[model samples]
Target: MIKVVKRKGKYLVRQGHTRFHGLKLAISEGANIPKLSVILIDYKNEIEEYLENLDGNRSNGLNPVGQAHALAHAVSLGYSVEELAMRYQRSTTAIRNMLKILDMPLELQRLISLNLIKKTLAIEIMLKYSNDHKMVLKHIEGFLPGVKNIETTTSKIVGIPEHNAAGAGPDTLNKGGPEKKNSAVTRKTLGIKRLSHKKTERLKSEFLELVESTHTESITNTQTELKFGRDSAHLFKNVNSNNVIFSNDGVQIILNDEKLNILLSLLNDENTAIIVSKPKLEELLEIRDLLKEY
Candidate 1:
């Protein structure tokens, strides 16, 4: 049935657009048409309900980009995304992705028309090429033919300018302008100070004493017969600093140097404890569980 809405005696197509076109063609060819079936809807109110069927039926012959343009048009006509999705029988995310196609450069939109790129690939290229359709086309023309996967090919685009990296390009990067006063990052900006060699050695000695006084007794006495979990294959233990010790069963971990000056400043405080490694904590937890069970 060719669905339509009569507005001021002028019938507007509401559904079955393909059927209506075919019916017109049949009439033009002198074919005898006795009965015509059509459903006339209220033009003022039912506009949103059946908008997808107005242009040759969205589910049948309309390409994705075409549908995206239609969706964009619907959005411009004061229809909400949710309303469009429901009327078009599409998920909200899918509808949004489709609508995104309309904003893309025409070349990328043409790829969508050619069925070479769908929503996912279009988005990937949008981010990867900084939405530069010329770069996208160059990549596709130069590399996409011999390659089977477009994403893997595009990801490996080498010798490309740093401008193409995600969210980091153009005005954000070095633009050959005068550098700002605080442009260079330093430890002072990161809440850590640049310590002199002698001061650093002094802090390390004090931290070694602190670790020894805090953990020597318990760590030396810890011996577990039952090991429920596998030991981590790689531990980030720096063995060079004898003055900064964090040893667990012969594995020594180094504390971050940024906190050294702060820790040395508060060495005499009684309530501050520095818990370091996962193995030590897990052993303590297992001991607690065993105590509860007993």
Candidate 2:
């Protein structure tokens, strides 16, 4: 798909590959060439250009995991939350929330991909427990041990303070005696308040049990499978996790961690060092000698 922007009197390509060979082939063969559709995009600046690029390709199998990587890369490359929000067609709050989700474990990513867990619920759990995986897992499994109270969990997401006027007096109020305590109690008990602890725990326990029993094993297995695949690829094919390239001679060059460490070690040593074989050492010394002469 080609995207174009107006420049002067003509439409100029803003994104997409300009493959001329296919058109040439069609023209030469006198085939009835199909008309290609072009999309016109309007961008105020470079930020918009980056957004357009992300959005245009995003719909093509860009799952939550893929989006996490892409968005993280954009962030590392200095795109601010506002710019990312505008580009991704999301609110700034959503962008921030999504960025937080990037730190999710592989198992959670698997669950997200399978649509087994709702993004909102995951975010709530993460926020409530400060992204402690153990707490998140235990809470999901219907075991709210220790301080993992439903009241605290709901309060954070629902925008209610843990200890309000009735529980803990407002900061501006002076420390006082029974009169202030009575007023606070009266205010708390007067109207409809949070559910009783028993009812809340019962409902939460049921909900968590249902969610965990349904999804946990599958997601955990998926995480294990993903890890195995990556490790196997590196071991058998010499295809590292990142920065792998195939040269024209059909050789794969991977600037992976092991290779990088070796290279750095060789560079740090002033004298010729043994690396791989004697010829390799001679080649390095030759390069060093050439650099010295220059």
Candidate 3:
């Protein structure tokens, strides 16, 4: 005979229904309905409290365990998957994937729990190295222990530019190249033991003399009264022969040491110049003499 019993909101079969029915038909026997106890437990509240406690204990409070428990609670609390995802700053797909990690190995789960691996890297490892998970774990164990010295390691791995390695650029390279070659040639030609200060001064003097002799005629013409302004009788101002006048065409004579030094400095720099004021022609001539001595 079959008998049906209801206990704690669940049904249980105690005996065969057919046999119970036959026995009741033959004897007119009455069947007893067992008392059912409804013991109410706040399961939802208990689950929520457990999840919240787990979340508080997790590294970054965003690990898989905490996330799964929270998500499950959210679902039980009548939140849609999309709504739960939005609340947790994740995509629905990511939430689903997090749920999937619940089936991964315990070591990997512990790695996630301890924050040894970030979520993104952990996801990458799982996707690429799942077949060789042991090897991947070994790599992480061996390599990821210390702080990385990125700058030094990168410099060593990738070399610096040859010229820039010594803190020089194109301008320095260009200027230094000729002088470097010339110094070697000069030492060979003159049989100099070393480049002494006296010898350097002498070479500079000779170079200056050569420059002056080459421009002698031009300097002489600068002394004459040249035309200034419109067609006139006496607008011919005397060229400041002592002052050095540097123009796009050639040098003009003014003759001050300071002004000559300024012009030479500008010329050495290969920079453009602007005329501030007119200079004395006599002072500039004296500078020409001084420059010749270097």
Candidate 1 global TM-score: 0.42
TM per candidate comes to 0.42, 0.36, 0.25
| Per-residue alpha-carbon lDDT of candidate 3 for residues 247-274, written as tens digits (9 for 90 to 100) | 4444434434444445566777566654
lDDT of each: 0.50, 0.47, 0.42
lDDT of 2 by residue, 1-294 (tens): 677777577875545533434665777799776776778877766545544555554323354544555566567656888887886587666666566656765445444434445565566555556568877666554421222222211211221112222221111211111221111111133232567889867866664554333222222212111123333344546444444433333333344344444456678757343324545444433333322332
User: Worst lDDT window (10 residues) for model 2?
Assistant: 168-177
Error of 2 at 69 (Å): 2.5
Candidate 2 residues lying further than 4 Å off, grouped into runs, are 4-30, 34-50, 58-61, 141-294
Summed over model 3, clashes come to 23
Candidate 1: worst-modelled 10 consecutive residues by lDDT: 166-175
The runs of at least 3 residues in candidate 1 whose Cα sits more than 4 Å from the true structure, single-residue gaps closed, are 17-35, 45-52, 55-60, 144-294
Model 2 residue 37 CA deviation (Å) reads 8.4
Estimate candidate 1's RMSD in Å.
22.7
- lDDT of predicted model 2: 0.47
